[model samples]
Target: MKFILGLGKILTIAFWGVVLFNQLLPQPVPFNLLINAVGVTVLGLHILEVLFFNASLRGRSHRWFDRLQILLTGIFHVMSIPRQPQLPRNG
Candidate 1:
């Protein structure tokens, strides 16, 4: 359980680190797209982490605060998505 939590925290930090580094460092368009793709992937991983924790909590060392945090983060994650923007086409 501790290991799982630690892994989750590391993944969360790594997601933010990539976002920060992408913003700070100059990069080619393709690299920028790659970073954006990674950001999306990390968000998905966070949701997965929350779900896994929810299931594993049943028979393991459990903390209400941790569960609450995971639930809230999951909610925020679901609510944060926006519809895709319309793209312009060449004439």
Candidate 2:
């Protein structure tokens, strides 16, 4: 699982690299438009993930760094974070 998540992070970074690099091409290809659209869409989804998981990030160390990673890697970064164990309540 850890390896898979690491692989995912690498792939995500590579994808973003492609998206940014695609924008700099001298002669535009038809697929460039499609790539741009997909890149923007994925960025939106990553932002949504950060919003939805904001509560979980409270009190965590390096919270800002985690948020950045979440933006870059999306669910892959989220899955890699270890969950805090729940404390039992004395009812």
What digit string (tens of lDDT, one per residue) describes model 1 on residues 15-71? 667777888984689988888787777667666767775644454344465555554
Q: How far is candidate 2 from the true structure (C-alpha RMSD, Å)?
A: 1.5
Q: lDDT values of the candidates?
A: 0.59, 0.93
Colliding pairs, model 2: none
- Residue-level error in angstroms, candidate 2, position 45: 0.3
Full-model lDDT, candidate 2? 0.93
Any idea how many clashes model 1 has?
A: 0
Best by lDDT: 2
Q: List where candidate 2 sits over 4 angstroms from the true fold.
A: none
TM-scores, each model vs. reference? 0.43, 0.91
